[model samples]
Target: MKKISKVFFITLFLVVIAVALGVAFPEKFETITGNIKSFVATSFGWYYMLLLSALVILAIFFAVSPYGRIRLGKDHERPDFSTASWVAMLFSAGMGIGLVFYGAAEPLFHYMSNAPLAEEGSNKAFKQGLSYAYFHWGLHVWAMYGVTALSLAFFQFRKDEPGLISSTLKPLFGDKMNGPLGVLIDVLAVFATVFGVATSLGFGAVQINGGLSHLFGFDVGFTSQFIIISIVTILFLISAWSGLSKGIKYLSNANMVLAVILLIVVLVVGPTLLILNMFTETFGLYFQHIIQMSFRTAPLEGDNRGWLDSWTIFYWAWWISWAPFVGMFIARISRGRTIRQFITGVLILPTLIVSIWFAAFGTTAGNVQNSGVDLTQYATELVLFNMFDQLPLSIVLSIVAILLIGSFFITSADSATFVLGMQSTNGSLEPPNTVKVVWGIAQSAVALILLYVGGLAAIQNTIIIAALPFSFVMILMVIALFRALNKEIR
Candidate 1:
């Protein structure tokens, strides 16, 4: 309590007021949030697309430019963690549950229902679906994160500033960052992180409940999801209490292992040849059209424009909202690396790995649907488990997925509490246990409240709305980073 900064109290108060409003007027809450979300997506859709495209370009330039030689810390400093452990922790913290949640469902949606640019249920739609999944989960998503994390690491580790998002802007704002403006910036960051992570937690709970209901005789309702969230909340709070090193590290490693196992199993047990073929083809397709997809606004096509709003714009906002939490966590683990090394590791490596994961899952799901199975009939949360029903060792796959989602849930929530604690406690590397525990509970409560209000739709709407303000903060960070780097070189 003593070590906690005013940001904690202010953000917590805001969160409490939000939860109260959500509970008191659930329908109104849903309607207002949905309307705001639509407006942002419609009006600023081009902005989201352009900003993300610029970030991707900037990330590549940083990796290849002379500035690449700059180290995040002292030139003599070696990395704090092994490359393997560092990748595991960052990947787990960055996009663990999302990969599992949407691995099959998203591609399936595009292939069978609504694709970005192709006719539904056509061969072109099939190829375009996997390619679009790669587009959403690949380079652009990571660039948003890589750029944010790079700014934080360079400022905090090399420039010896406190580990806060606002600190990165000190070059542009100077001592003004220490005043009320800085507090406002940090509050927006904390607010975005809370909702961003809470939405992921909500997805985890829903999918876990979906898996359980598919396996056993359980109901897939708010009641089951409530229990799932409660149990995982307890598990993650315990991990949060154990501090950063022991709990998050081990859980992250477990998440990677489980994820790999599931990926391999799906590849082997499902359409192995098709998965391989699709991976090769989609890999080429994604790279070939990467620029077009990056800047795509679908201005002339009304249907394509709507698709862009629902999927591409929504995902851009989602990654932006998640940038603060994931960026900070990546920076904490990525000490003492050169700017080139950091950008390559963050942008390229993960992009390739996620491409492979989606190829295997998406190809397999598409194959199942092509064989006369109606996967589109099922809800999104249940689609993955239902797809497993067509594969050999279905029970085994479902069990592994459930366990994997649970582990990812704990890792993500635990890491978020740590990040939230850091943001709110004046960027303490090791914030107080009381602060972490409170944040742990607050995020879980937010997940539960959003679930009660309108399920996944409510969560998505809130994320898009929350991300709009912080998106401007990210622009300032990029300018500040370039300013500081120029000064260092001179």
Candidate 2:
């Protein structure tokens, strides 16, 4: 009891209380959260861009530096899982639900609405559509993950630091890291993780509910989403209770398998040649535009030029917000790997998977559009399922997609609860059951309330706002990581 971090506990308690109040007064909470999100966008959206660019630059330097030869653990230690299992866990941790959630919707949205200077529906817009999708989901997002994961893994395994985000920066501040500032970083991390996972769960519920409507004639509304999120919350709590090596691993591997199966089916049934071609072409174009896109921001052009905020900035913020949870989970499973190996696997493999997944699904969606099917009428959550509806064996495929999503939802939630427990319990690798269940319940409740109160679109707003502060923390992490690594090498 005495070892518990009072700062972590108090921060979580305040977060829970605020969320409870939000649930009690839905409109006011939405208004408050909305104002904050808007402020983050209007004021600091460019900061997210600049900060993300810096993080990516730093990650690339670390990967190619001589310091990359350093092992995450002792020289003799090796990875806990096989290569395949490790990659599966990485995908599950990084963005399993996100791929399924945005794979189809984003491409179409980008195709249709090019804001500010975008000539809407132009051939150029279509080109930008695929490029932007690849851009947002590509190396930079993974690099952000790489920054935090490498830092945490290096410090925890090599320096004997605790498995906390704050401790990763101990190199920058020395003993001051053990004081209030360190606690603040970890507290912000916990807060961001809670909302980040909750936002994902909330949007994922929209997908699940949308699937239910497409398959079974259920209506897509708050009640159905609430029930879906509740059932999902319970399953993940049970998984969290089962501990990491068992339930979480089994589900993640299973999800990777199922998700792969779905992608393969789409490739075979849909336009295989076009999908492959788009992937190749987009691969080049993605690299071509990667630099321009990284620093791409709207010129305070007009009232409607906020598209960058809605898409790119939103993505960067969301990815940063998820860095703490994803980074910690990756570090936990990533012991015994070299820094170079970790960065390559973390940055390259997942980016490849994302490209192939989007190529498979996005090509199919394009084919559907070519057949004169207008997909934009369906809700964003329903977009992927709608595209699946037109494919052969739609029912079976949609069911599989939903199950994959549910598995993702479970893995993300369970891992988050585990991380939350660890963060609150003085960085214990194995947190208490009480802490896990409490966090599990609180996470579920926040998702449900956000859904019933603000609907699907509201999900990312809170996360974008929560992620803003953590963006700075992540930069500090990268700086601190390099300083420590350089010292070790010298």
Per-residue CA lDDT of model 1 for 318-437, tens digit only, reads 999999999999999898999999999999779989999999999989999999999999988899999999999999999999999999999999999999999999988898889998
Kindly report which residue stretches of model 2 are placed more than 4 angstroms away from their true locations once superposed: 1-3, 115-118, 300-304
- Report, for every candidate in turn, its global Cα lDDT versus the true structure: 0.93, 0.84
Model 2 C-alpha lDDT per residue in residues 1-490, reported as the tens digit of each score: 3156875577778777867777788888788878888888878877888887877787778779898899999999999988898889878978978899999888778776653335766556655677778889988899889889999999989888899888988878888878888888888999888888888898788898889888899987888887898899889989999988998889989999999899988998888998888888877888987888887666655645378878888888889889999999999999999999999888898888898888788777766876789888887888888898788878888999999999999999998998888888777888887888988988888788778678755666788888988888887887888788888899
> Model 2 lDDT vs. the true structure?
0.84
Index of the highest-TM-score prediction: 1
Query: What is candidate 1's CA lDDT for residue 388?
Result: 96
What are the TM-scores, per candidate, against the unseen true structure? 0.99, 0.96
The superposed Cα distance between candidate 1 and the true structure at residue 168, in angstroms, equals 0.6
